[model samples]
Target: MRRRKKKHEDEHMDESWLIPYADLLTLLLALFIVLYAASSVDAQKFKELSQAFNEVFTGGTGIMENPSPGETQPPSDGEVKSSGAEKEEKKEKADLDKEEIERQAFLKDQEELKEIQKKVNEYIKTNNLEVQFVTKLTDEGLLLTIRDNVLFDSGSAVVHSADLNVAKELSELLVMNPPRNIIISGHTDDVPIRNAEFDSNWELSVMRAVNFMKIILENQELNPQWFSAKGFGEFEPVGDNGTAEGRGLNRRVEVLILPRVTD
Candidate 1:
């Protein structure tokens, strides 16, 4: 036996530690998967992870059961609902603030218009031109309506020399604000016209407006760029064409002091 010695049987050590190493590797893989799921916001993946964790830790218990030990619960439904409601409230408040700003601006414009109306009315009273020209504040801004008789004779487009001072007074008023808009519009009675200079009422009305605009421009202080002229022959009548008085009322010129938009 000693001679043989079984060739001093080759000795081997036990490798039982491999089982624990394998288990550690498996746990690390599971941990990495859980960490990835936690960082993501995908609801379906989260549900799958929850079910897998339940199977692994709780022996396949309900999917809603907690998998980790001493872990705090996820956000409650009430918390999520409260977050959405807060966002809605913030939006509503911003909208209301914008509306309030617009309202204040509107009020300020209204006050300014009232002051302009007062000044214009006083001027008309002072000059005793109330019958021929009248001023008023409207939504479209300050309006000055002039009877055709005051600016022209019969079917002519010429500005009467007597009314030239009216243009001067208007130009003086606008010189205070050079950028203010002055829109002159002419209207004529419904009756058709045959003339040597103008073919129809449309031409006569337009020329009438242009001539008056020229008179206002003679001041040289007013900005010509802010002036515009338009004509509505018999189309935009202000009175009935069947009566003489109504026809007189229909033939007129209007000057609009346009309102400015406030920021």
Candidate 2:
């Protein structure tokens, strides 16, 4: 029997829930990646990254016109040049300060030397020793000149007992200050020497310098290492040897106190 066609019910698909589940999984994965990336950001790099994003999204608008509190822009060329200029200026200022310090020290040394000169002149005048010894302050420093009559006799190297006391007193006064090079230069007249002790004026001058230096070294506290004894002989004679007066002036010993300076 041809029964009325049985009406079959349409089966409903249950896959509608799978679409929302896949979409949620995708959104969760993206959120986890963003959280991980944000967790590792530091201050400076994060600032720069924020600035880059702001510039990209601002579309050249008011948002990007002024930098935000946490945004850091790249260093401009002007800033870099200014930084270099500041360093160079600092170096130049340091050099100028050093030079000024040195200049002040030199001036102070000159003043001290001048005071010492005054004291020395006072002593010479008070003791009536001007005839044998003369002192003056020059650009070189304090100059103490001793004639041959006070230091030696003809070509003798031995210092008299009287001069020994003078040398000792000078050494004591000199040791009152810091150590410096003390140049002891000996000069003589051009006349030939005919003495048994010295064959020529050079030997006589050298021996006299040594003998005088020895007397000065009587002070145990004085440093002998700073002393220099040079025999200028007749070459550095202050006066001509042609006349007796000039020869007398030439026969002398000079003690030079050098000025303080840094090389």
Candidate 3:
């Protein structure tokens, strides 16, 4: 009897590992189900799912808040209002910052242009060129006006050899830290002309501007790409073309220095 009892005890197999095995199988099955559901889950639901898994694996304390895949708790009225106010405030602040930056840039450009104008003014004063040359700072940019006769002979497109030094000096002043665009425009009086070299005042004005621009660009430091020439003949006059004095003012060339930034 003793031998038979011992044999029966030895025949019993150890089944203690089956508990942990069963637990592992249950965890794996849960993992697969959660992964499958995650495919169609919304943003809120995915967040909740992530928290749920974290709590389970970490053995932390939290109520398993497994809401439906598409269901989400909306914010209260007060929260909605606060969020909107915050967004609007942020937008206004951003706009103000942008405007301030633009303002600073415009002011900086204006200051630089003013310095350039001062230099040109000094040159004009030293040379006693007040009657022939004038400078104005306008919203568009700096305007340097010269009587046509100062640079060109009457009814001629060619720049006078005597005034080549003037153009060269102006070109030297134009060299700056940051170069700006320059335009040389020509204007003519109302008197009509049909010369051998020019068909009309229009042709004369255009050639005069082009020739002046060429002289300015002869300075190796000046970029030809930044210089352009145009003509407005007897149409966009600064003075009346009816009188001789007014006509003298009307027949002029303008050197316009444009601002790098504008309002």
Which model scores highest in TM-score? 3
lDDT of 3 by residue, 32-103 (tens): 867765675365666667677758775654434445445555887999999999999999999999999999
Worst 10 residues of 1 by lDDT: 63-72
Residue-level lDDT tens digits of model 1 in 87-201: 9999999999998988887777767667777777788889888898888777787788899999899999999898899878877766644266779999999899997888889
The C-alpha TM-scores of every prediction are: 0.69, 0.69, 0.76
Q: By lDDT, who's the top model here?
A: 3
- The C-alpha local distance difference test score for the whole of candidate 1 amounts to 0.83
Whole-model lDDT values for every prediction: 0.83, 0.78, 0.88
Error of 2 at 6 (Å): 12
Q: How many residue pairs clash (N, CA or C atoms closer than 3 angstroms) in each of the candidate models, in the order given? A: 0, 0, 0
Question: Could you tell me the TM-score of candidate 1?
Answer: 0.69
Pick the winner on lDDT between candidates 2 and 3. Answer: 3
**Better-scoring candidate (TM-score), 2 or 3:** 3
Candidate 1 RMSD computed on C-alpha atoms after optimal superposition onto the true structure? 8.4
